[model samples]
Target: MTLNCLAVDDEPLALGLVCAFIEKTPFLKLTGRFSSAVEALQGLHTQQVDVLFLDIQMPDLTGLELARVLEKSGAQGQGPRIIFTTAFNHFALEGFRVDALDYLLKPFNYEEFLRSATKALTYFELIHKAETPMVQQAPQTQPIREDYLFLKVEYQLIRVAYSDILYIEGLKDYVKVHLLNESKPLLSLTSLKALEEKLPAERFMRVHRSFIVNLEKIGAIARNNIQIGSAHVPIGDQYKDVFSDYVSRWT
Candidate 1:
């Protein structure tokens, strides 16, 4: 998988070096190079960047600040994954806090740069694999069994079975997958709309804009809410008709 990369550094020399490294890597494509985090943030909107090579100590909006901005920006939630490059090693902890793929100490060589780039490549490859829906053809005499999906939680991809899921709650750019027999829901960095496409329609249904419940896990429906064990998920007006139609069948 080719990862479109953006390089951002206040120093022209540093920016050039990172861009050069990106170009040399066969799987990495240099999408844009910026002298400051401000320009890089602006470029992010116009470009299709999968990874970012950023310098931490730039003037105005610093790399760390920019990373925070990107984190909170709902529009940029699924933005480029970061790889911090700086002369100082002090910001390593902060970089990882922002979920940076790698931290490269400055005066680094191509070998060091390549390692970081490769790490980003591996991450994106896993992301692509997880996003892809699995299609299987079963024999006419057999039944199609439900399978599991990978959820990107922080830096790790967690495997979750469809049968174990009781419901899903959308939280902006993230989703909380409530599982059977599990006390806490598995939080994943993904949109509800993206996840809906991967789920089987007959087994899962959206009762609200922010909620998708496992149809089989519904314990009872009372008024405008559906009960799934202890959780009472509200049924949105927009989805009431479809949910009501499904309810009518059993009635």
Candidate 2:
């Protein structure tokens, strides 16, 4: 799905970079470019904007203030998916609280921009698909189970087999899928909770808020940590009893 994107920033250079990035991305369509939040809001009223690239700090009306206005106006799900762009790191938490699709720090490269855009693209696609009516109805059939899943990383979809995954680590808004044979972990713009829902419960268990380990990949269990190959994943205090029960059943 091509997102109708609108970019708003006071800095001409930042605006230019974002516009250029949007143009380069195949799934993104630049709907409008505004030098101020006020102009962007006007653009939003005049046309449809599926995604918004907004700067946090602006004169008169900041991006956060604009977002709050949109939220209060009941644009939480109907409005554009926001991706805040700023140089400050402190606004990251606030961005999430505002239900932003992603956060991009200033001076970010095209790669970083692509990651955030891809996330917005994925979200729009999912929402659109759910809203669209299914035309073809066939005979009832069981769902086909899969051993692998596709992950969007660096603008490319990488297939990762469930058997190859050693563990999964949640780092704020992103997740790292560690593989047994691979040295580099696969990174994607997604939450651990989202990933956990995608994975089979019988095979994967959440041992910590920041960790999910493959049942077959556990090598050793030390008091507070579980070893998955060379990686030692910590077991969160709240999850310890549940994990211990699971281990006891197997032992």
Candidate 3:
């Protein structure tokens, strides 16, 4: 599947380079090229844009501000994914906060550009797969079971077994999946609520607004806290009654 791209940069040279990169990429098509964010906003209204290569610093409207506008107006909740191309490295964190697919430092080579473009390709491919309808229906007697899920981390999708996930922590727009044996948790650009919907209800429970724990992985429970391995997760007051009811059945 080909992704329609838009290149927006105030610098003539920078804009030319990004447009050339988009032209050379096999799966990306350059739909529009604009010198400023305001011009790009107008272009967005005219055509469908799947990915945006934006420069953060502009005279009238900054790339970051434009991203917010798209989030609210375009493509429901899933707006066009952005790949911020800028000279400054400090805006990297802000770019990620806006859910950019990737950030390309200015003066980057074709190889670097391709790497970022490839990430956008992977992201769109995943979205396409998710949106596709199933061919056949399952029998009433037999239900489909999913043992693992693909979590998007940076550019690649990491396959994580449900059994391996100890718990999930929500941090604004991102979620951290704590695994059984892994020392470091896997960070993905998705909310805990979104992940909760994808997880098996029988095996996972929301013990807190910001935390979801694997029911089978819970090691111990005391007061308003749960122990899962070496980590201690707090149980929010709102979820206390439900958790108590679940524990009462086992007791």
Candidate 4:
């Protein structure tokens, strides 16, 4: 997969080097190279970038701060994968927290840059293959079974099984993916609307504005709520009819 890439750095020489490296890489398409983060943000608005080669320290907005802004901007799972390029070693840990794929220490060579770029390439390929829609065959054929979905959590792509899911909670631009196999919920930058599109309609249903539940995980149904484990998920008035129709078919 050819990744549309952008380079953002305060230093002119540094930005030029990144651009040159991108040009030499067969699979990376350089969209733009900017000396200021402000201009890069504008470029981001116009372009569909997949990977970002960014410098950490800058005036007005640091790379870390820009990443936070992008995350909050409601780009959801559509945001570019960031690969931080900094001279300091201290920012390495902070990079991963903001969902950075990798960081290149300054005064680095092409070998180091290629390694990071390859990592981004691998991730994009896996996600694309998984999300690709399967073509329908015959009318009488059985439905395709969905086993799992790859969720972009922080910098990593986590494999979440349909059987392991309890419920999903929406947090504005983010979503909490609760699983039966794990104690901690997987946090992702995506809208409930976007997530609803990714999930299979037969096995998963939106019960409320802020929640989607795994049908198999429902322990009981309360008056206006569905009980799964200890959580009581409310049924939204807008979605009650659809939920009722689905339940009536099974009952």
Q: After aligning candidate 3 to the native by TM-score, how far in Å is the CA of 8 from where it should be? A: 1.0
CA error at residue 87 for candidate 4, angstroms: 6.7
Candidate 1 yields a Cα-based lDDT of: 0.86
Q: Kindly report which residue stretches of model 3 are placed more than 4 angstroms away from their true locations once superposed.
A: 74-76, 133-145, 148-159, 171-174, 189-191
User: For residues 1-251, could you state the per-residue lDDT of candidate 2 as single tens digits?
Assistant: 67899999999999999999999999999989999999888888888789999999999899999999898988756879899999999998788667777889989999999989988877767555534433222233654456877675643346688999999999998899999888999988789999999899999999999999999999999999999888899999999999999999986
* Clashes by residue pair, model 1: none
Ranking by TM-score: 3, 4, 1, 2
Each candidate's root-mean-square deviation in Å?
A: 6.9, 6.1, 2.8, 5.5
Candidate 4: minimum summed lDDT over ten consecutive residues — where?
A: 131-140
Question: What overall lDDT goes with each candidate model?
Answer: 0.86, 0.87, 0.88, 0.88
Local accuracy of candidate 4 as per-residue lDDT tens digits, 22-57: 999999999899887888888899989999899999
lDDT of 4: 0.88
Query: Which segments of model 2 are wrong by more than 4 Å?
Result: 9-30, 33-35, 42-47, 53-57, 64-141, 146-161, 170-176, 184-194, 208-210, 220-225, 234-251
Q: Which digits, one per residue and each the tens of the lDDT, describe model 1 over residues 191-250?
A: 899999989999999999999999999999998999999999999999999999999999
The candidate maximizing TM-score is: 3
- On the 0 to 100 scale, the lDDT of residue 58 in model 2 is 96
- Model 2 has an lDDT value of 0.87
Error of 3 at 29 (Å): 1.2
Candidate 4 wrongly placed segments (more than 4 Å): 1-8, 12-50, 56-81, 86-118, 131-146
lDDT of 3 by residue, 1-251 (tens): 89999999999999999999999999999999999999998888888888999999998999999988877775524557889999999998888777788899988999999998888888778766644422232434554576888897864567799999999999998999999899999999998999999998999999999999999999999998999999999999999999999999887
